[model samples]
Target: MRAVRYHEGGDPDVLDLEDIERPDPGRGDVLVEIEAASVNPVDAKFRAAGLPRLPKTTGSDLAGTVVAVGEGVDDYAEGDRVFATGLHTGRFAGGSFAEYAAVPTDLLAHLPEGVSFEHGAAVALVGVTAWRALVHHAGLEPGGTALVHGGNGGVGHVAVGLADALGATPVATARPQYHDALGDLGAGTVLDYGRDDLADAARDATGGADAVLDHMPDTYLGTDVAAAGFGGDIVAIAGDTATFPDVAAARSAELDVHMMSMSNLATHSDAPDIGPILDRIGNLLAEGRLDVTIDRTYGLDEAAEAHRAVLEESFLGKLVVEP
Candidate 1:
């Protein structure tokens, strides 16, 4: 298997294309012949900030056919198409950037009949992230309102789609060029962060959202705070922040900040029972109720190029690498 790996965390240039031994499935594991994998910010983060352990393979989300199932695995079989995301487990654990990967059966989901390999690969990471934020953390309600930052981003787009399907009005922030795309994705109003003020824009759009789903919470905390309706919640899926805007001052107007890391079994509740979420999203894809957008596609060998594209913020949606 050819994998893009690095001995140390640094710039994207550090990624080296090399042939490595294919991973073998262990008990309760499934060996997938990867057809496509998606590049995410975490892929780059793990490269630039991976553990001291050298020679780490970087990739989380993958879509492929099951070529083999290990001992104790009875739920899946050879030739089954599957979608998966890495759980940050073992060394060489996340070798999805290559032709094969051995993933735990618990992290795997069946790809819907109509969902293409690329779409399956693209949806898992972001879908799970959005589901955790909207359904698990904030408990977003039907007929509620959510203000989403980076509405054009991979996770943000999925959040908008799910929020709409769940009967919430979504207001999103993006660049002017992506405004129409957000609207088409079911965002009731699109605010251009580069051109408009988010707080005022969100307030005017949905009369203040019941919750705010933010990617860069540190950068937009104040705006999200101002845009939230009294007692509304704020969920941050990405970013590292100790505290948000002052809460004591907003008495009777609660502004609680929730982080997606809470979804990790190590920190918060046990890993959610995602079987139902995947089934629902699978139906949405099968019926065209949801759209998985691929901004660009690269061949497996060009994994470094894919990382560079994402690091440079050039792609519009999920960036995929076909093996």
Candidate 2:
């Protein structure tokens, strides 16, 4: 099997395409022949910082077909087409960036009838993160207002669509060029993030955003704190470092701020069964209610190039690497 792995993490250049023996599924696992894998920002971060295993396959999202099943696996069988996040029970078994992977059945999700491999891969990680942030942390409900920083962005775009699907009106910020895209996804109004007074603009757009999904925590954590309506929720879905929030504003508004990590759900033993949520997301994709944007595609051999592109380019959506 041909896979992209890094002996020691440093940068995009660290990722190399190599020939390795294919892995067999262990107990309660499924060996999926990779069709497409999606790269998220975390993949780059993990690549640069080193991983739990040396020479690790770093992709976390995949859309593929089950070619073999290990013991205790019955939900799926040979040739069952599926898409899944490989980080289950917080353990890393080579990510999806390869020709094949042994994924636990608990992490598997059925790909809907009409969704393509690329779209399925694109939605894997970001989709679940957005679903957890809006549906759980934000406690967002229809007829409410959602303020999404970077609304047309990777996770932000999904937040917009899911919030709308959940019946809330989402207001997101984006570069002027992406305003229409956000608007099309049911953003009440897409603010120009270039301006500094976003809190004020968001206020005017919907009187005040009821909930905030902060994608750009470095830039918008304080802003989200300031804009959230009294007693509103603000969920931070990204950011690796500790962020300082406006204590005064938070105290004044009595805002409920929380941090969301999909990784915890993927790895934590106490995490809820994601299969149900994933199934719901699949249904939405099948029904065209949930939206996904596949911004770019690369071949397995071009994995290094794909990593570089993710870092250098301002992609409109998810990036997929096919094997």
Candidate 3:
């Protein structure tokens, strides 16, 4: 099998597609013949900064068919359509930018009947992240309002739709070009993040958002604090650490602030079970209630280019690799 690997991290150029021995499924694992994989910001970040181990395979989320299952695994069978994220898992683990990957059974889920391999792969990580942020951590309720920043990005778009599907009104921030699309995805209000009145407008739209899903908390934390209603929850999914700009206001409102990383949950023993979450997302996809937009697709040979585009280019939704 051919896989993209980086012996040492530096840049997208470090990724090399080379012939490698196919891995066999170990105990509690499933060997997937990867049909499609998606590129994520984490893929590029890990590619450039390096992981704990060297000579690592690139890519993370994958959708394919189970060719074989390891010992102690009976939940899945050969030829079952499946999709998974966090391919860097327990024994026999490898990244998804390959012809095949041996992923742990815990990370695997049945790809719904109508979902394509490309869409299945594209939604894995981003869908899980959005679901965790809005539904799990924030506890956004029906008839509540959700303020989502970066509403055109992968997770943002999904969050908007998920919030709407949950019966909450979604107020989103994105560039002008994406307002119509965001509205179509169920964002009740779409604002430009650059507007000086962003905080005020978001508050007015929903009478103060019940939850704020922030992607760039370093830049938007204060705004999020300002936009949220009393006792509102703020979930920050990305961005660098910065001092909270309005500690007094946050305190006054009795806000609940949280920071989360899906990768951490996938790897940590104390984390909640994600299998059921993925199952719910699969159901939503199958029902056409959740959708993932594929901005582009790349072949295995263009894995390096995929990495470059994911970080350096401006594109909506997810980029997929058809292996």
lDDT of 1 by residue, 71-146 (tens): 9999999999888875443322465788888887767788888899999888877887887788877788999999
Q: Write the per-residue lDDT of candidate 2 for residues 141-181, one digit (tens) a residue.
A: 87989998887667889889989889988888888988887
Task: Give candidate 2's TM-score.
Answer: 0.95
In candidate 3, which residue pairs clash? none
Against the true structure, candidate 1 has what lDDT?
0.79
Candidate 1 similarity to native, TM-score: 0.93
lDDT of prediction 3? 0.88
For model 3, residues 1-323, the per-residue Cα lDDT tens digits are: 99999899798899999999998999998899999999988888888888746788987789999999999999999999999986654332379999998888878799988999999999998998999999889999999999999898988988998999899999999999999998989999899988999889988987888999998998999889999999999999988875698999999999999999988756787876566788899899899888888999999999999999988887778899998
Better of 1 and 3 by lDDT: 3
The whole-model lDDT of each prediction reads 0.79, 0.82, 0.88
lDDT, candidate 3, at 19: 95
Listed per candidate, the RMSD to the true structure in angstroms reads 2.2, 1.6, 1.3
Error of 3 at 273 (Å): 2.6
